[model samples]
Target: MKTKNRILQTALELFNEKGINEVTLRGIALNVGMSQGNLNYHFRTKSEIVSELYYNLVEEMDEAMKKITLDQPVFSLLYESSLVSMNILYKYKFIAQDLHSVLESNSELKVHYLALQKMRKQQFLFLFQNMIAEDLMRKEELKNEYERLYERMNILGDNWINSANLFFQERSSKVAHYHSLLFEVIFPYLTQKGKEQYLKSL
Candidate 1:
């Protein structure tokens, strides 16, 4: 692998194994078997490496999102998307694990992340509209009900790693377990036909 890619991979492993705050650029260099100055030649600081990794994660998710379409049943699309997202998050588990601190300390990343989230929120709204039109999702009983549901999903999606690390004894199933929980947020809002379709999917 190229030196730059190796640095990022090694840094990701170190960050995931040790907390991001706990792993310094020097530590990453040592892990990569390179001199600190050489590592600095590739990345000036830890935050720079982190910014690259963050964008790398976003790029991967964007690529995955491109594969999904509205042609499938609503629940199945959601389940597939959730599983894909969980797998990506698991690969870069440190990001979700240290999200608050990582964003809080990096102003540029925080701005980009907030903007990305806004786009995702809009996408979810569009999905809800489509599902309602198809009679697969019930009309919102209250104003912004599905908006709130999206927020709840956001919370769970971003923080489930912490819960899994603390409560789950079997590491292998953590992604699957949390993927189901995250996808379940919309279950109550599904119409009868939707429920039937979703059951058939299972």
Candidate 2:
């Protein structure tokens, strides 16, 4: 990798192993075998590195979601998307924490983040609507239920990610028990046969 890319990659690994506050430019430089001045030339501040990591994460997620075609079963798409998202969380836990911290501290970033979240929810809702229109869902009533379910799921997912980070910091079990919990909560809303199939696949 290029020197700048190597530094960013090493920094992300260090941040994930240690919290953002614990990571320093000097440490990153040492890890990359470069000078602190060279690291600073590529990324002026830790916050800049955090921001770039966030953008890369979002891009990765978008790319993953794009690969899930509309022809796929809704339940399958959702399950796979959940897995992809969870993988990102596991790999970039520190970047996720940095985003949470930044949003907590800066109203502007919070607003932007919320808007992005709203857009995501709307996209999910649209996907649900399409499934309903195609007779893929179990019931028409599910259309309304999905909106509520989606919002609740998002909240649950955020909490799960945060909890995972805390547990990781404390050297707790590596198993992600919350994923199964999430699958159970969401399985009920799938079409009857679809729910059975999804659970079986799991």
Candidate 3:
């Protein structure tokens, strides 16, 4: 790996092991076998590193979701996308670990995150609408409920890593399990055909 990428990866590992708030830039430099100055040359502030990772996370998720054809079964496409997303989130696990404090400290990051929230909410709403159109979700008046479900989705997506880290000793569950747990959050909203098809696809 390039020096810059290695720095980011090492920083991510440290942040995951020691925690985002607990780790220092100097510590990252030491772990990566470089002076603090050299590290600063690449990332002036730890926030810059985090911001880059955040943007990368957003870009990767968008790219993955784009691969899922909307014409396919909504549950199957979403399940695959959710798995991809959760894996990306796991890769940059430190971001979600300190997302709140990081956002609170950096106004720019906060603004970006808020904008991301809006975009994701709209995206989920659009997907839900697609499911309804495709007869995958119950066709009913759920304007307010859809908004609530979006909030739920956001909450789970942003915090699952933190929850897993705090409670689980094994990291294997990330690739094997928790992302499916996220699906459970929305599976109930599916129509009978949707639910059956989703189970079959799994």
lDDT, candidate 3, 1-202, per-residue tens = 9999999888878876788778788999999999999999999998888787778778888898788786766667778888888888888788888888888988988998899789878988888888888777876565588888888888888888877876777778765567878888877888887888889878
RMSD of 1: 1.2
TM-scores for every candidate against the unseen true structure: 0.96, 0.79, 0.89
Candidate 1: worst-modelled 10 consecutive residues by lDDT: 70-79
lDDT of 2 by residue, 36-78 (tens): 9988999998777777777777788788878877576566666
lDDT of 1 by residue, 1-202 (tens): 9999999999999999898989999999999999999999999999999899999999999899899885876677888888988899888999999998999999999999999999999999999998889888999999899999899999999999999999896767898788888877787999998888878766
Q: Score residue 182 of candidate 2 by CA lDDT.
A: 69
Candidate 3 segments exceeding 4 Å error = 69-71, 140-143
Highest lDDT among the candidates is held by which one?
1
Which wins on lDDT, candidate 1 or candidate 3?
Answer: 1
User: Which runs in model 1 stand beyond 4 Å of their true positions?
Assistant: none
lDDT of 1: 0.91
Model 2 global lDDT (CA atoms, 0 to 1): 0.73
Task: Give the better candidate number (1 or 3) by TM-score.
Answer: 1
* Candidate 3: residue pairs that collide: none
How would the candidate models be sorted by TM-score, starting from the highest? 1, 3, 2
